[model samples]
Target chain A: MQSRVDATRCLSCRKGYASHAAGTCKECYEESNHKILDLETKVAFLQFSSSLDPSSSPCFSDVVLVASHDATDQTDLAPPVPIHAHKAVLANRSPVFRAMLENQMEEALSGTIKISDVSHDVLRAFVNYLYTAEACLDVKMARDLLEMAEKYQVEHLKAYCEKLIISKLNPGNPLNSFLSCVLASKHKAKNLLDAALSLIVDNMDKFVELEEYEELKKDHPQLVFEIYEAYHAKQVETAALKEKK
Target chain B: MQSRVDATRCLSCRKGYASHAAGTCKECYEESNHKILDLETKVAFLQFSSSLDPSSSPCFSDVVLVASHDATDQTDLAPPVPIHAHKAVLANRSPVFRAMLENQMEEALSGTIKISDVSHDVLRAFVNYLYTAEACLDVKMARDLLEMAEKYQVEHLKAYCEKLIISKLNPGNPLNSFLSCVLASKHKAKNLLDAALSLIVDNMDKFVELEEYEELKKDHPQLVFEIYEAYHAKQVETAALKEKK
Candidate 1:
């Protein structure tokens, strides 16, 4: 038995494993490797060059998007800069843009779309994503983009942002997780909400010790109740499993 | 050893492999599964809604392409129909289009580009491929698209067509393989050229018996010479290997 086990070799890592530690047969493993390669090739073929890059040449932009800032917001004194884009790209990426452009809306006739309450950088990134399906995201950028993606009904971008935020959720940081929970709920990001909820439920005692917990209980009592409900359900499930054992 | 081999169950198929037929350790298999999922998600995200689809709402097309027909070649009497598209998409996909549109060439200024010696269906497919890196390819369609892709410098589409053509290459059918070799050489499709050459070399005796071989020798003697050179090199390598044994 020991000799047979020793003779076994993992095709992936080229190492010996115990019989119980086997993952796949040779045929299945090779099939999976081929699947990965095919998928990677498809991804490379599908990825487009961004029209926003100046070096791409002849963007032939037919529409402009200006981030309309409030007069009272004294962030910058300069006039709002317009981002050049193609109506076709914008329409293809977002249903909101399609409606705005296709139905002879005021923005369509004017060839200038004034987007209210969004910063220049966020709007630029949003448009770039429509062109290339790519963005360099941080926490703030992800949150901002998530909101814009939700408003535009760009499901791909929204899911991308949700994945990023969910990956960043930490059970060790209760306050951050709580805030993410709030943001997810607001944006209707179900996956992000679930991840944040799981983190909070796992560390409920630490979460309640934070000063923000009292404020959250007072201000958004429904959200606090929901978290407690999830914790209760988890406890009940664990108790039932223990009883069965 | 028999009992231990039976104990080693594949995680994927849940079947036991002989000790030497083990593929991957549990950790590497799980990692590969995750990587495949990640790549699949990325491919989904990157794939855009093609502007050619009318149901996708507004296309906002800015340029038109008409497949020009030669008067001498009477395939169809219908006037050349125009395909609407975005200049930005065309330029982003093909450097040839970028140069033509960016340099304010005759086609760029006219808002209409005339493509000569291409069927309407082939031209439409080519334009659609620029927007969505996909095509339904048969032997004739693949050959036509490969020529266009090579002419327009669309490397992705070229590779796609080459892969399709190479997949259809058969050593059992020497005539088809010979034709594919000729086409690959004409288009400079390196992968297709290599695959077709390999098929032809493997069945050199069968290929020499074909009627097309005489015409090819008389017309493109250089290509025929290249095939003989490859066959000679392969024979030398085989002889050397046998001597070493």
Candidate 2:
């Protein structure tokens, strides 16, 4: 009887629970633990040490990327810093780079690929992510990287950025949500679009009064129409559910 | 009373249990599920698409690895097929490759690394593992790759191969265990050494009569002594436990 009573106690929390409060069977809990450990090991194996340090021996960098704006700044006496990287890594990570390099384009012939309208720091981070799929990102950095990732067709990095942006979206920050929606729609980020749209729809009274929303309506009226369409569909669904009840 | 009974049911197995049979509390189980999902996402993000296809556009391969035996066979009309790879990837994955390539060694200058005592298929798999961190291994393949992984100081691959080899280790096959012990000792694989030693110690009587054991005793007497020492220590520990009880 004592053993049976003990058996009802939760293995993880060590608290006694009735069947309704129980989380999992012993076998499933144990299996999940093993799966977590295995996944961690695999993640460790797959993660690469970022080849960002140029001074490190045997970097084997075959190409250099220079930010175009920085390069053309004639007033600056010091030359624009070039970010060194492997062509193979760039080609593997980005279809844009693959086509540019593989087709013997001007960038391929010159060995220096000039990226337009990007800062040197952002370019460095972008190249670093090519080698190591990691970036320390805040909202602005995520947005910056997302733009570059979208242009380069690095879907993994784009998805990562979108997730970060969506996490930061708040009901109180309708302007930010509106801007994120615009960015998501521009980049074909369906997940971010849906998240931002839902947030805006839930707080529509507050969202419509934002100055940014007025500007967005003038510039991207098609997007505003889509949002209205989504809002209407949600309303219809809620009314139908209420009727069913 | 019905609702209270329902609350104690296991969430995973969907069965009722007393307090002792519960695996985890609700909070821990939910957290574990979230952790598993996060880890799986991380693994997917970190995994690189292997750059192994030579004919693929923009492969950007700057170095080739040739199997030494295949290269020397003058009678064969077909030249030894070289494995295409990037020096950056090789350097990133292996300290040996880093040293060889970064120091402007002959192989670095020539862009052709001659790997001695490895077959073409094994060499190809090894390079693929460097890029993708994946390999399909049987016992024989695991042993072969383990040797290369040890030589190149690819700790991730070595650990992976050791894990596979250990999983395949069976007490019924004492000779296989003995050989694994020897290999582990030679390569300083502590985990494999411990597992193989435990298996051999547990079945010492059967292990002692094997012809491979006699050969191991003759050639590697120190390893045989270590195994005996472990067996004696285990026996002493077991006797002490019995005495205490």
Candidate 3:
């Protein structure tokens, strides 16, 4: 029970601190602690097993999703393994799956849905996210999942993949930036689109010399226009700020 | 920016507060915000729907839990409604369920698992907690669920119910306190048991005169001995403190 003039320990880390280093007062600290505890409990309640084994039936999956593209791989020609999952989980996470299942579509009756344009690994990762809402992303996996998320109307996955793409964004690697821009436009990922556009605009001189830029101009010319548009907008904004100064 | 000498407004609630009312430093505030966002995302990913519809198969429930006690309400001759649930979810939440289901027990073959003694409402709440880790609990429901959680060996749910029960404990209500003591002891809810026993000992004079105390003594004389033991122990401790003073 010291006076306000005396230094207090932080409620979070419990380290001694002056007023300037204060995180919160005792009242606020206790309130935030309770809120965090509540959130953690909710997370615990929501968590299901991450097991994807068909035999285990971790979430007791009623439907199985198979990657059709896996058939193209000559290494394992027998058949593509199916990913087991539940319709209710799919419906809760994605409206596309919900409608497909609820309507008793041909796929629902057959109990197997084939997903094309995705390898078995990517399909597995996508289905895993549907059940667990988690993914480990390399650049290619993130790109593929971002497109799939957009196609499936899974906004959470799309936003998550977009963040992953942005986190790996490198201005020095303009080819990566260029590819991200094309992917962003195709998926309508505003965050990724903005990030890639900014990188391309900032490194215009270096990026224009690359062969990928010429290919992008020939392939995705509309996406190139967006970069120019953002570049000019940024220039005008910077000039306006200078004039105000 | 104002100097440390001038009180800064809280970033959290955005209130004009003095230094004494500080919630957190700017660094900790931003960090906590990010932490909360991460936690919320995890919660979103973990959340499975709480639908008990058999046809809906919210988590693709393989087993149906029927409250056997509900059949004993002779006025309703019809069989009790079965609560649909996922074996994977039940197995993940309770080791008892996992062992039973995995070992190919009679209940596993039957597809309908009979849970005796609990009513339909309690069974539904119990299954709901398995999927969502949440229960709308009053004191009686909390006690019942706590016992059920203990029976199922679902420590998370048991701890959750114990916290709720303890949070709502009223020391003045000795009848509630006495019952909680017996209930807590039965379930081995150390926190609740300790709290209830402390309350009983503190209000010994008023509590002993209550008719419920006599009933508890007649029914569970062992519990009565525990009360006296705790009371004498607390008295000895108090006397020691007095001697030291």
Highest DockQ: which candidate?
1
Chain B: TM-scores of all predictions: 0.87, 0.87, 0.87
Could you arrange the candidates by TM-score from highest to lowest? 1, 2, 3
TM-score for each predicted model, relative to the true structure: 0.90, 0.88, 0.86
Candidate 2 runs further than 4 Å off:
A1-23, A50-58, A71-78, A211-213, B1-58, B71-78
Q: Distance (Å) between predicted and true CA of B183, model 1?
A: 0.7
**DockQ score for model 1:** 0.61
Error of 2 at A133 (Å): 1.0
lDDT of 2 at A239: 100
Give the TM-score comparing model 3 with the true structure, all chains together.
0.86
Q: Where does candidate 2 chain A have its weakest 10-residue lDDT segment?
A: A1-10
Q: Candidate 2: how close is chain B to the reference, as a TM-score? A: 0.87
Q: Residue by residue across B5-66, what tens digits does model 3's lDDT show?
A: 45545555544456556555555656776778887877765666546755554444578899
lDDT of 1 at A110: 99
Task: Report the Cα interface RMSD of each model, rounded to 1 decimal.
Answer: 2.6, 2.9, 3.7
- Residues B148-184 of candidate 1 have per-residue lDDT tens digits of 9999999988989999999898888988887888889
- Cα lDDT, model 3, residue B1: 21
Model 1, position A59: C-alpha lDDT score: 65
Tell me the docking grade of candidate 2: medium
